[model samples]
Target: MNKDLEKLACKDLIDLALLMPKKFDDLRLNDAPILNELNCTKVVIKSKKQLAGKRLTCIAYSYNWECECTITIFNARPFHNALFAINKELLIYGKLNDFAGLLQFVNPKIIKNSGEITANYMIKGVSDKSISEIKKKYLNYESLKAYDLLDEHIKLLLTMSENSSDAMLLLNSDELNECLKFVEIFHHIRRLNETYKNDTLYKKLKTHDINKWLKSLPFSPTNDQLKAILDIKSDLENAKHKIRITMGDVGCGKSLVIFAAALMTYPNKAILMAPTSVLAQQLYEEAKRLMPGFVKILHFSGAKTKFMQDELQDANFVIGTHALLWADISDASLVMIDEQQRFGAKQRMRLKELATTNDVNPHYIEFSATPIPRTTALINSDIYSYSFIKELPFKKEIETKLITIEQSKELFNHIRIENEKNHQAIIVYPLIEEGKTNTYKPLESVIPYYEKHFKNVYYTHGKDKEKDNVLSEFALKGDVLLSTTIIEVGISLPRLSIIVIVAPERYGLSTLHQLRGRVGRNGVKSYCYLLSKNEFSDRLIEFSKTLDGFKIAEIDLANRKSGDLIDGDYQHGASFKYFDETSDNIILQKAKEYIHKLQDK
Candidate 1:
């Protein structure tokens, strides 16, 4: 075996056994067809003689056919002369050529029929005879029911487990030719897991009375939120630095769950860092309102240097933006980060390391407002602990509708009515201003129509230096706000009840869902209008029906065909090469099953 092959196989019996042959070369054919074709045969060496320039010539003919064959060897050694004896028979395999009605075999693999044993195989970079010998030495595939899938090949190294379902069934997919390839990949990842177990272990927990603390909350928690809290509770019960992620849709109460985690830590000082100052301040305010007065909460912002330093020393729960990284967190044992994906890995990790004490990693929990596919979660379960809040605490009464140019009047009327009811509305544009080559004027064209018809009008985009001020003004008093997808993640507007996306196709379903989530935060009626010229957007129609973020993720998964399973940022924004993590649940499950079977054996 080559060192590389040994390395891949790990010299493990099962691994070697599972290395299926890539292809096979047939050497069992006897005589070539009577027609003109090169072939193999058992030929008798009728005559042999040495030629000029270290060459040998042999006149031969097939034993059972009327055809003659010529065997020529160049740079012939003395051993060649001994092998090509007069009237000696030999079994040969190679391509033959008809030269002027004369059949000839040149430099063919010659196997002497002189009581010498031989075998055929087709492993790349390995001698065929050696592989055949290994097969001969190992395979004892005798079954009462005569197995066919394993045949006599794979059985050579692997025992057919009775628990394994029709292994061939797992490999066959008429719709996608990639099925067989995915089957191979599944086995490969399973094998890698045997040596590279990524999950960790930590010390057990003793004092975390979350039940009493949970009872103090004003509003009851959703089952999913409670389950996530329980999961975190279990994670913290141990001394292992609890690094867990809680993923939820917008308004799914992830903040409250983070609060629960903080209380679970109890005496262990807890600190949280948000991506934006606005988000940090929002969380700080919420924590103060819900948390007991005994829990001193501190938020550092602007030039509150003196007050910040004073609170840093006494605060039990500290919340701040990235600026908190510079503050002292020497006493913190539980560090929670909100909107974890928004921060850079170095920033997140640096914050994590800040809470580490005496080499004892602090319990770290992260919050994400976006939802990933379930299959992805399963595949990465080994990498990091994850909790999902798939459902919201309340069902949003948001109605999503597709609007066209023909229905432009109807859409405007609805927005006006929403505003009349004292609720706010926003119109999202694909562009802040029209490009010179743009077929249609974007925000510029709509400004006159909206300003002429609506009460207060405000517009902002990524380039607007005063965009934050515009957004704040819009949130406070503006009735109609024209913007870009920048409103997808931040700034919750409870009174904002309607969103009209001018060109829905420009954004993905996930992005659209994030925008839709911006509305109906206060349980008030909401409406989302997807305005576009393209009428064939069935994905948008389907997305309109489900308010559940997890369901929206499934829709998003179905639209994209390829992505990698893992990426550099610890599985964040990773794609898959062999299988779609969004749709290949069965394949991933089978891989997990195969690993368990191998381990049990």
Candidate 2:
């Protein structure tokens, strides 16, 4: 064994067995000496000699056969001449030929060392023949039995390689290959999850403490929210270094979970980092009002806070925007990040590092409003503890509609009627001001038309100086707010009833789902109108039928190929390397269950 192979990450025979081949070739001998079949035979070179210019020829016999097996080796090196001398015994594996009145082996790999197979393991950037030998030595039914994996799944795994005695009888070659793919993917995910062992770091959370805090709130938590809190609570209680990512639809009441996390980590200094000032301010206000008064909560955003810096540091719970990444809150034992996708890999990892102490990492919880596929959530389990709040706490009555340029008049009439009812309306244009694209009308171009029809019409975009104030105004007294997708997160507009998106095809379904979430907070019938002209309109039309953001995520999975998975930026979504997140949930669930069982053990 070389140093490189000895250092391979394989812990035991199971690792060797689980290294599935990217492909397999048939080298099995036929019942008889059938021509055109790849065969392996033991032979003695009866007449062997070097020909012109590295060409070597040999006549070999196997199994006391009368027919001579002619072997012509091309580009023979010096070692080949020494090894294939007259009367030397050899094992030849290659394509068998019936060219003339003779049986022949062409370009055969003379197996001086049996079980040696060339393979590319990918991790080492080098190829090794010893891998085949190792697989042969250790990859067996008993080796699988030692791992304690699901019996059915393991049987499926071996059947893919045709290792089971009756596997081929049950499945044809094509069927086996197809089913074997699931097996290979199952192992790939299993190996990724196995690395999470031995990394638990956190103190147990008391449910009674959480119950006491819940009593302080005016409203009760949703069952899904409570389930999420319980999962987080269990993780906090069991591990020292906790990593959990909470994903839910926008307006699914994730703030309660964030506040609950802070309350659960009471007296241990919980710090929260939100993506924007508006969201940070909103969460800060919620925490201050909902949490126990004696807990001492503070908000810091954009600059040094009005409160004394020491007070900010010493507070039981602190909420801030990106300013939190640099805030010196070393007493922090729990760190929660809101709208975590707004930050890149460097910033998220930096917060984790900053919150961490010398002995253990702070229990980290990340909150995202983007709903992801269940398999995607499972894949992410390799790095983060995943929890989903898909069931809405409050029923959102938003009905989606697909409209085109021709339907502009009816759309305007609906907005006019909604506004006349004192119900607020938002028209979200793709562009703040039209520049490059001509297909979509910008806000500046259309505001005049909207202002002419509706009263108290105001407009704002992401760069608006008074965007928060504008949103505040629209939520209160304004009848119509013509804007961009700036109101996607954190604004609770209970009166806003309709969101009309122009050129809706330009935005992903997730963003549109968030924009649609702005309405229907108070269970009033809310409407989402998607205006587009391209053939891409069908997706938006399909999107309008369901209100489930998680279902929209499934459509997103099929429409958009996944992005990078390396940096943990699942916001744009990381592509699955092996399994299809859409079709492979069964395997994903099994892998998750297997890894979770291991963690428990």
Best by lDDT: 2
In terms of lDDT, the poorest run of 10 residues in model 2 is 161-170
lDDT (0-100) at residue 36 of candidate 1? 39
> Can you give the TM-score per candidate against the true fold?
0.65, 0.68
Report the lDDT tens digits of candidate 2 across residue range 354-458: 876665667788887764443344334465667888777667777888877898889888987888777988888878777975777788998888778789998
Candidate 1 versus the native: TM-score? 0.65
lDDT of 1 by residue, 410-479 (tens): 9888888988988999888888676887644588677887788889999888778787688888889889
**Considering only N, C-alpha and C atoms within 3 Å, which residue pairs clash in candidate 2?**
201-239, 201-240, 201-241, 202-239, 202-240, 204-237
Displacement of residue 392 (Cα, Å) in model 1 is 4.8
- Model 1 misplacement above 4 A: 1-216, 240-243, 300-314, 322-332, 340-360, 373-375, 378-394, 436-445, 463-465, 561-565, 569-574, 597-601
Clash count in backbone of candidate 1:
8
Task: Show where candidate 2 strays beyond 4 Å.
Answer: 1-198, 203-213, 240-242, 247-252, 305-309, 340-346, 373-375, 379-394, 536-538, 569-574, 589-601
Error of 1 at 284 (Å): 1.2
